[model samples]
Target: MRIAIVNPNTTQSMTQAAAASAGSAARSDTVLIEVTASTGVASVESHVDEAWGALSVVTEIERCEASAERPDAYVVACFGDTGVSAAREAAAGPVVGMTEAALMTASLVAHRFAVITMPKRTLRQSEQVVRNLGLEHRCTVLAVDETVAELAEGSLHLLDLFTAEGRLALDAYDAEAIVLGCAGLADLVGPLQAALGVPVIEGVAAAVTIAEGLVAQSLTTSRALTWARSSSPSEAVSA
Candidate 1:
């Protein structure tokens, strides 16, 4: 199976990091195609950044669709799952979002999951994701000491901060699982999970795994409901 991994941020390093993690988790026969957004913020930090990054992600999806070797599934690498609905509509195959995959993966292993994210600005967006997934009762959103941009730059100090916050979520909030709330923090999943002694869901890896399942099952997002085409059939063709 072929899978397309779209990194919504403009930074190629972030795309590389996402690809590395996804590659490690994916099956040996699965072919992975990684694409970085050509235009957007270096890192998606706020809702506004997510909004702008979405357009770039959609563009990449279109490009993938028109490619000679199109993917059987698509994975939006952003923790926010930016542009996922749009991409699902445009593609013929399944599209998986990082946030949804992580939360779903967490739910299977633990009843209560807490997200450990960056600074304060992105907390509400993560909360919105929980609410959208109907996981508000099962999940909590928390932040670490670093900003989104800082983590993308590979800050060593923030790893400890994330571990500390993960501990708090486990001990204080009584969380049974932790979801890493930023794609930038994907590399720290193993260490954090080991230290906390609980399941740690990294969005990128989770999304890749979910995408693989959907592809194997020959399933894609249902266009008959939430993602139904907005334009008329004729209008869609004319455009």
Candidate 2:
């Protein structure tokens, strides 16, 4: 199976980081394609960036059109899951957002979860997304006192910083699992899990698993559904 790991950021490093994490767990036959948004925020950290970055989600699908085989799944590798609904609408395969996938997986593992985001401005967005997805009943949003760019800048030591923050989010909040609310932190889940003694879910890894599971079940967004097609054109970017 082929999977597209679309990073909704212009940063190549961030795109590569997401691809690496997802690729590690992908099936041997799964071709994990990595691509960055052609135009958008360098890193998604705030509501403004989330809204703007959401627009660039279709960039990868547009680019992949030239290829002989389209990817079996499209993964929006930002924690906000900016344009997941639209991507699903536009694609023949499944389009899963990292945040949505992580939350779904977290729900299956634990009764409650605390999402650890990068910036304070993102906490509201995270909460809004959880509510929008009907997971607010089981999740709370938390923010790290740092930005995603800061994490990438000192990536060599990110594991330590993330573990410390993830532990605090879990124990302090009494959360059963901690969702990594930034795609850039996908690689730190194992360390964070060890440190917190709870599941630390990352969007990249979560999205891939969800996509594969959907494929296994031969599932895709229904074209006949009113809500899927009745969305306004202005709201349509990709699904």
Candidate 3:
């Protein structure tokens, strides 16, 4: 199966990070086409950015669908899941959002969850996403320490410091799961999960796995709105 992994921003580093995180989680036979948006905000830190960044993601999904090698499913590589619902309408496959995907994955293994985001802005966005997904009952907190951009371009020396903050949030909130709330933080899933003694999840990888399942099930975007209802007859007479 072919899966299109779209990093809905212009940053190459974020795209590279997302691809690396999704590597092992994808099906061995799956072909992942990593893509980046050409025109969009750099990173989504607020609702306005989240709303705006969506257009770029939808545009990329349209491009992917029109290609000969159409993706079976599409992974939107933004933690905020910008434009996911709209992309779902444009694509002939499932459109998985990182925020929804991570929460779903974490919920399967944990009773309570908390998102470890970057800075105050992202933390607020994360909370909004949780509420949007109606996961407030299952999620305990949305915590942030470092700015995701800083973490993306900054230092490996801060890993321990950041992870410790995440661990504390989990403990204090009685969270059984810790979601790394940046597509930029995708690389730290393995070590963090081990160290935290809980599922330390990355949105990028979680979205990929969910996309694979959607593909296997032959499920695509449902045309209930913009695409509208079918009006044409197939002309193949029913028996």
RMSD of each: 2.1, 3.5, 5.4
Weakest 10 consecutive residues, lDDT, candidate 3?
A: 230-239
The residue pairs in collision within model 1 are none
Clashing pairs in 2: 86-238, 86-239, 87-238, 87-239, 88-239
TM-score of each: 0.94, 0.88, 0.87
Q: What lDDT tens digits, residue by residue, belong to model 2 across residues 1-239? A: 88899988899988888988898777878889887898888888876787768778865665574479888888888887877776776677888888888888899999988888877777777787799889887898877767788756435366676677667766776789988888777657776787778887877888898888888899977787732644334356663
> How many clashing residue pairs appear in each of the predictions shown?
0, 5, 0
The best candidate in terms of TM-score? 1
Q: Which residue pairs show backbone clashes in model 3?
A: none
Which residue runs of candidate 2 sit more than 4 Å off their true CA positions?
A: 153-161, 226-239
Give per-residue CA lDDT, model 1, range 101-210, as digits (tens): 99999999999989987777888878888999999988989987466777666645577888888888988888999999888676787788788899888888999998
Candidate closer to the true structure by TM-score (higher is better), 1 or 2: 1
Q: Residue 120 deviation, candidate 3, in Å?
A: 1.4
Error of 1 at 226 (Å): 1.8
Candidate 3 lDDT at 109 equals: 89
